[model samples]
Target: MILIADSGSTKTDWCVVGNSGKVLSISTQGINPLVQSENEVERVLRAELMPAMTYISDITDIRFYGAGCRDEMITVLERLLRKVFPAAVNVCVYSDLLAVARALCGKNEGIACILGTGANSCLYDGEHITANTPALGYILGDEGSGAVLGKLFVNALFKGRLSDKVRTAFEAETQLTMPVIINKVYRQPMPNRFLASLSLFIGRHIDEPDLHRLVVDNFRSFLVRNIRPYCRPDLPVNAIGSMAYHYRECLEEAARAEGMRIGTVMKSPMEGLVRYHSDI
Candidate 1:
């Protein structure tokens, strides 16, 4: 049996596959070693994850792919998982970006991207990443991500780029004036999450020409700034995340404009991950 987990800032999806080919699914709050302490992560593993594994002892392998699982965080997560699943002999922790590459590209060489709360992209050579353009988070980069889209939309709303009617509707619906938005973004915690949450409003108005252009332009920036650095124009750009899935039309348009093509736009990596592991 093997256990696999794909984690992001918001949630984690756990899959348990038995030797008999049976699969069980479970959901738990996300675990980010970069943000949460070891005790906090261990608490979730024991309280939420452990209870879901009825055949825990049968598991001999564990793979954890998640956001913030890098450098020292990898060791931290490996220690916790080892403590939680002591029966497992093989344990590996990897970045969520690698997970996207593996899930979308499989064993084929291509460009893989993640457009979620934040943005990330890499050139994958089937089994490993050859190059990456740093995301630099929502503030410095993350062009096509939900957080950046919301940032652009909100900026347009307040800076007179959007129509008064649209602004009025947004303010009325979200009850977020410039003051509230300022507080939420500048003073409050998890500003990226707060900004990403506003993408729902952008999605609702995406059909409008201005809104559509905004989304397309955002994706264009992502391609120009992030993917272009790889200089692999011949490779089809594949992506995994809510931002890529929900706004696929806009993403497709941007790709066409950049003389690129879209491939394997998956909303989540769990299903593909399961398939990849099953095949292995």
Candidate 2:
């Protein structure tokens, strides 16, 4: 059996494939090594994931791709997976960026990007990442992401950049005052998730000219700052994440404006990832 996991900060999607090609899908709360301690990760694996598996001994291979699974953090996740799946002979931990690259490009050369709660991009020559642009999280960077879009919408709303009608509607709909918003963003945990949640409101009001421009500009900035650095305009830019799938029209417009094109924009990488791993 093969077990594959795709984890974000908010959720983790798990897929188990048997030798007979039977598949079982499960969901669990996210396990990020950067934020969750070893005990927490172990608890999630044992408590949530183990319950979903019918035969743990059957899982001989485990492939985990997740946010914050880079550099030294990779070791942390690998140790936890090994502890959870002791019978597994092969356990591979990799960055979420690699998941997007493999899922979107699928052994072909292309620029792969992730635009979900956070933003990240890399140049992949089929098997490995050749270059990457640091996302720097939601505060300093993460352009074209849900968190950044929320940040921009809130800033414009409070700063009078948006019309009174929009502001009034937003305040009425969300019931969030500036003081409350500040408290959540500044003093709360997981501000990125909170900010990304506001994308729902943005999506509701996407037809608004100002809101449409805001989304387009955000994607344009991402292209200029993140994708342009790769210097490969001839190749199509592929993306995998909620933001890319939800606001594809705006993303495409931005790409066209920047003299580029979008290849594939998938809401999640699981479909392509499953295909990629199945062939192996």
| Candidate achieving the largest TM-score | 1
Per-residue lDDT over 65-98 for candidate 2, one digit per residue giving the tens place of the 0 to 100 score: 9987979998888888998899999999998999
Q: In model 2, which runs have C-alpha deviations exceeding 4 angstroms?
A: 19-22
Reference-based TM-score of each model: 0.96, 0.95
RMSD each, Å? 1.3, 1.5
lDDT of 1 by residue, 111-185 (tens): 999998889999999888999999998999999999998899888888899988788879888888899999999
Please list the C-alpha lDDT of all candidates, in the order they appear. Answer: 0.91, 0.91
CA displacement after TM-score superposition, residue 272 of candidate 2 (Å) = 1.4
Evaluate residue 78 in candidate 2 and report its C-alpha lDDT on the 0 to 100 scale: 86
